[model samples]
Target chain A: MSETEALESMVGGEYKYGFTTDVEYEDFPTGINEDIIREISRRKDEPEWVLEFRLEAFEKWKQMEEPDWPNVEYEKPDFENIQYYSSPKKKDGKKAESLDDVDPQILETYEKLGIPLQEQKQLQGIAVDAVFDSESIFTTFKEKLAEAGVIFCSISEAIQDHPEIVKEYLGSVVPKGDNFYAALNSAVFSDGSFVYVPEDTVCPMELSTYFRINNMQSGQFERTLIICEDNSHVSYLEGCTAPQYQDNQLHAAVVELVALEDAEIKYSTIQNWYSGDEKGQGGIFNFVTKRGHCRGDNSKISWTQVETGSAITWKYPSVIMQGDNSVGEFYSVAVTNQRQQADTGTKMIHVGKNTKSTIISKGISAGESNNSYRGLVKISPRADGAQNYSVCDSMLIGQTCGAHTFPYIESANPTAKVEHEASTSRVGEEQIFYLQQRGMDEDDAISLIVNGFAKEVLQELPMEFAVEADKLLGIKLEGSVG
Target chain B: MLEIKDLHVCVEEDPSEEILKGVNLTINKGEIHAIMGPNGSGKSTLSKVVAGHEAYEVTQGDILYNGESILELEADERAHLGIFLAFQYPVEVPGVTNKNLLRQAYNTIAEEQGREELDPLQFEDHAREQLELVDMKEEFLERSVNAGFSGGEKKRNEIFQMAVLQPKLAFLDETDSGLDIDALKIVANGINELSGEDNATVLVTHYQRILDYVQPDHVHVMIDGKIAKSGDKDLAIKLEEKGYDWLSKDASVL
Candidate 1:
């Protein structure tokens, strides 16, 4: 067959994680109101201060409007038709004491996703906080983390168990009124991971969170917060997936991070939410607001993400370099295929003197899809001698796909320097023939070229994730020949 | 070992304009044949067609390897069947190290031949031997496949790949185009060492400079997409001295 025909065949692979599990669950009525926010806070048994925080955020969300600045085009989400909260029905509302007490169906679902529930069989040296629907099912290796004075648990539990820490850092980096989605997430956010690394101590193992949206018509509003004390280091990973549905689902999440003096935090995400059918009829609208604050001198924060799913994705995991000699980095690889549209990038804000930031983004578009990279680099007057470097590259696979880059740089300091480079290229016939002449088939050649194009960002992921991301790109562009 | 009968080929973009019109040639085992031609004489097209390049349509022809028709095979399929082509300007594939590509290509051919595939360690040892044959440094294996290499380095890499694949029918298409004197000798020497009684070589060039290093059993002067004259190695020297005008005029009269 011809190369073009083979590429067209790539649009037919089904989403492997699209099967819904049969689990009995309770969900709130569709719509948002003050009572609903209060009920959610009461269900979690949050303190009065936390309840007041949600109430104030809900008031702001009621006055806010969804922004349309992103380049992606999608139907406006109907807030009234979405279930803001959903959770698996439990016996007498008791939390699971161990893996055995958790629902068998939920455990099976995690197993099918290649996440073993047994601690021995789980990924070695990695603690996981598995969030299903609106609640954390289980958290592994808590004892090991607690031995080092680290706090890792579901945000709901943290609000009740560690209210002082939660109240001090919550909404500190990403305030409740930061953006339209962030405001919504702050009001009725369900469950997400919360981590705290102690001063001068490196976390013994990697911390991870796996989020799954199983209930139909339920919007997943998860809020994640992480704090690193002075001289501490932590690496966190996040992964998400959802079952297929004929109606669109909304996922608006907020992630806030804080790094103290000499602290370093690395956050990585592999978003594989259900991307809908080939016609783009039903899929998740992933609009997320994630940002980190380098609060002390010599602090560092890096965000690395590989986004391969979601019909329409709009997110910018950004950083604020508030401390002198702080470093911020963003590396991303976004792939869109079969009617998917993604507009994602990062924002670097330099506030203190001698701060530095780097941004590298790679976008791959195939099968009539559109991928865009939009980023901003800003240096305040006080940030003298600040430096920023940005590289954005896009690779178009077929004739119908589109790629765009939008970069904004503003520097008020005379010594501040910002560099931006952008390029767009297509997989050409000559590149395919060159590999073919060396005994590689069409699919293999396309995978090789696509991986090579995204190597700069893929290599930034952890070892296991780097391999998984490579295979994910191959599957997403199975037969596509650029 | 290979035969081409009344081959008529044209660019797929404009098939009516034939680039190789009714060409015929043959090469047996243990033989080296060199095709010399001027510009636009279809020398490169002939080699590409033999290697099953998809851009060129074989309108009326059949290519047989070991008495089996290979006109319908793909380029990679032909490579697995012991057909190799040394490109004039090898394409650069960034981010794929030479060692990684060579291991893949070598194992692909090895698996098809019912031979045990080499593991990474074994392949590294095997590839080092081929690197020495091309006078290449061990560091070259760590570099991306031909990316950012000089003209001579690319040529040497092509020969190095040829030495590894060990094809029975090898076509060197303008392999000496951008080589310096030292590089040219190394490439020629590598080709000579790889050639034996069980394999054959076809050298297509516009100059006779490469022929001085590797002797040819037969030299054919290709004019207007056909072998207008065939003789011993002296034919290349004559063409070098008299130019293709004499051969074209002689063929037109005949």
Candidate 2:
């Protein structure tokens, strides 16, 4: 049977990447230690300080305990059973210029996912970095991007080519001691996107990265770093998917952004990782750490994400505004179905005078799924005139599902102003009746209402990715109502 | 075009109490029918039964649209067959845009009938024309579907959608209950313009004023889960002249 037909036979049958690749790699033993860290550093040819940082992070990860605060149930990850690194054998050599030159099996995997792996001469101003398994497969549109003074390449390449830039801001926003998953990501991260926008440059086009989890024996830990200089602007899109498997896969990634004076960074994530089976068994365990920092005056950082897959999701793409007149915004729509659970939100920290932030979150829970919106907005004592507005809404499609919102607001500054509004409601029979009265079928009507409910977040996505995201969430949520 | 024979419905979980008890009604093409009754008298339930609301279980009933039964159809299926219901209370969808939703809904029915789908520009033109027919502001299309619309704006939007969809059997359930004079007339006028010779409408209201704007071919006084009286437009004026108590007293000592 074809991959689509095979996936159609699997539980829920909507995810297209239920097929696995057939490439052999020299896998590391299932374990983590100082030796493993050193081995990864040695394999990647990293600088001495970077290796030292990894060792330190691994030690901290050992000291930290796994977080139990999220409303998710899963087996505790066994550090001793997880192989730290697994890469394609050919990646030890030079990157291929075309898909034909790459491994046939790996190229076919990309083709199945509808991603064009071959580098196009005319890219329409967008640059792409494709990551397969635990390796940076290829970084396309390099010369075109370099001509515009835009640094868009893999993080490993950035460490080799621009060590000073990478070293100065590697873990500044999200430190190695931040959380368990983040520390693990720091210790064994393989490869992810690294972008830099020079001063006064608009960066010309969007930068995209497609992440595929191909190695079934080893979990994938990827790290991404983006920095926008003064008066510069850039929008980054991150897409992730994994091959289906009977054994649940694990994905832990770290993404950090730094916005300098008068600069702006818009980060969009469309996470369609393989959600487990129809019986809600053997899916991905997605624990991610993403945070952005406004390091200079008048800087802005916005995060928009549409999360619809994964059996369990634990993530909160956060922002810290430390510059005067800085701004932060977060828009997210998380849908959980068929026993999936998500405990995700953001943190907006105001440390500078006159900083502001706006947060809008919509959660849709169906089919016995549990979804929560948990966030914190803290205004420090020095942050005079800090302002914030947060609205969190949840829509429950069935009686068996549950939706919860937890907002933590702490303001030491007397002059700070904070406003928060939250509501939980079900998709009522009357609402469906109203839409049907307008000549819509049950599926179309539900899609329309849901698209509207997540409009705030969907509008935040790039125009090219919005339609696909809508269709992805809509079709997955069809027939999900009680 | 619309007929309900011995309709019996109960709240899905509560099988003991029937909301609509053996109700029978018929509305022909090009005709206007009004069903007015006191609260809990099954006026709204009758409208919901014909539109296939999932919350109301049809224990024994046959709802026919153009001589074809729609009891087994989904809500949207009934709608595509030209059934429309202007809800007493509209729903609020925060993130979806009014224009995007309306266009999608209109195109779905059109496509099901083998009609061409409107391009974005063409959709925008249709949307503006319909909004103008309801006297709604042009900016309403850009807002999230009924997210922050006022009471008047919400009712106007219902009429606006009705005008755009142009169903064959329209059900205006309490369309004028909460509207001010201007909003009421605007809603009635939009409904009046959308009604045609080949299409039918059932106006369920509590007052005779809305009927003055959109005169009905027949007025139905629904009392105690059944039609107590049915007559021409003048009967609505009679009900307006005398309170609903008159009807109940004429039937029995209430």
Candidate 3:
């Protein structure tokens, strides 16, 4: 068999996101350099400070090599072979693009996911940039955000319009030198969502309404920053329930959040990238760095993520509590099917008096996949009366799959209270039978049990996102079990 | 409505050891049949086999529901064909709420029947009414399925589920066990209320206590792997007075 046929046949009804999009891509020269970074910043009309930040991160990234500490095995990504930038566009095909040649696989998935026809064309990157506004719903949503004093746009646009806020809070939570992937993302990161909720105001709606309109093909290395000022509340959503088909074999992204005095920020992500075939050939290597900071007294920051894609995923969405009486929470549900491998969890750092943190991590593995929860909870000496509670649970679907949990706890203050609980459960045949006897087919039975197992984390998502996340789980597990 | 002829069952097709040895039973519509037996006499096994449990394999037998052989059907397929089994010990599924399970099951059957499915709001009202039939509160629907439920409550939940599905034929395995007199009456009342001219019920139990509440049209005592004697409700009373020892000699005959 030809190599292309083998690759095409690898994706079927099981894994959703393996289609090759036919859009035109304007690529930079294959490889990374100082000139490439400068050209990237210049093309976006970035300011001088942003250019300097990219250069500094590029220099530091040159001094670092890829780390191999995560409990996952894959062919390491070749940095030299990777093209640094790909901004997809077709100048002349603006009109009638929605009616023609969107990949039928992509359309079928969107149809099954219940996405509207207009939005399906918009999400598939079929040149819906301007003509998709025939209904003006997305335009009205943008106006609503503007009227509510919420700044919502791409990160590059934010760099141009709101540079002061971007410069002040960018990388303040996760600096450029934090890790290898973050450094790379800082150097050549493309566009991602940027949200800012003003003080004394609540964002009118979840940020998905804004993201769904401008959701273009983010090829690789995306960056996001969200800031909630004093007494403000915002729930920001990243990624989508739709399957993301990318030609790039490697993905690196960075996300940072900041919450100030009496503010609350809830961040949710549903990542459904491609995870290759049963034998684990040609899939994405997802390495991302996400962190949030409760930087003021009485502030709260919560991270809820549903990760069900990628050939190999390594990330720890962490929270640092720096203000007295602050709160941090992390709720995650990570699923690995076939030969996928995911090593993910969170870190909760208590550095202030009367600070508290909660972490809930649930991992599910099916086929021959492997999933692990690695987390940490730390309390410093100044954090008197600080409290932390963490629970990590893993559920295995098939006999060949594996689940592991590694929890670390450190405390320097005697007055602080820390608790950790971990459990590994298998999806027993008996459990599946119980649900099946109630009229659900085998696939729906497994899906129901999995959703039930991850209910604690799934309910943490915003109202609309919670429903989509549940459906995404069901879609991922279709035909996975006999 | 249901018929089992010369049935033989074992744990995963192991020939040397069989659980059900040449058992035969039949039931028409609208009748309540009681299966009384001692411990390990294959009462529960018979119910599970009829329910198409994966733990048991039917090496030689034919189970017919509505004049069609159902041995080749999956458990879920049998369930859609109006077969229901209330387990002796309902497994505690931690994250699934009772309401969610019932709604999903009800809608699945309804969808197969080409009936309009109920939304969550409609299902809530429909399920809460079943809760009243089992003497359970609305809060009971919010808890996880059988998780952290007391023994009596689990049995009652099973009956509550039967009320929701309203199956054409049901096997209540040990439903009378682990229930107080008041709770037993509630369960008995629920069973009697759901049984109509279109459906049938088979009560698999050890004691005759539940028979006092919902009188059965016939009583059959299972011993070893097959039924040894058959009679009316008075036979259950006689077995309660004289222990199962009087039926042991008759059970060994092939």
TM-score of each: 0.96, 0.93, 0.88
Model 1 lDDT tens row, A1-482: 22122112212245777889899887567888988888888877778898898988988988999888899898899888888888898767866878878999999887777666676666677788989988899998998899999999999889888888899999999999888999999999999999999899999998989889999978999999999999999999898888899898999999999999999999999888889888988999999999999999999999999898898999999999999999999999999998999999999999999999999999999998999999999999999899999999999998999999999998899999999998888888777777777787777778888887888888988765675466678778876653
Model 3: CAPRI class: medium
lDDT of 3 by residue, A1-482 (tens): 22122112222245543334344444557778999889888767789999999999998999999898889997777787776666544345221234343435333433333333344233321111111101111111444578889887667768888999999999899899889999999998876767889999888776642111112233367678889999999886554222333332667878899999999999887676677667786566778999999998999999998888788889999999998999999999999989899999999999989999999999998889999899989999999999999989998887888898989899999999998888888888788777777898888888788888899998998764565466567667776665
Clashing pairs in 2: A11-A278, A452-B95, A452-B96
CAPRI docking class of candidate 2: medium
Candidate 2, residue A312: how far the Cα is off, in Å: 2.2
| Runs of candidate 2 exceeding 4 Å displacement | A1-13, A91-94, A97-100, A120-123, B241-254
Runs of candidate 3 with Cα error greater than 4 angstroms are A1-17, A89-144, A209-219, A240-248, B13-16, B114-122
Q: Which model scores highest in lDDT?
A: 1
**Model 2, span A1-482: residue lDDT tens:** 23222122222337766778888776577788889899999988999989988988999999999989998888887778777788787744665755556787876676566655555532354567889877887777788878879999889889999999999999998999899999999999989999999999898787888888877768889899999999999998877888778777789999999999999999988777888877888788999999999999999999998888888999999999999999999999999988899999999999999999999999999998899999999999999999999999999897899999989999999999999999888887667767776777667677777877787788788776666566666688888865
- Candidate 3 chain A weakest lDDT stretch, 10 residues: A126-135
- Of 1 and 3, which scores higher on lDDT? 1
Clashing pairs in 3: none
**In angstroms, what RMSD does candidate 1 have relative to the true structure?**
3.9
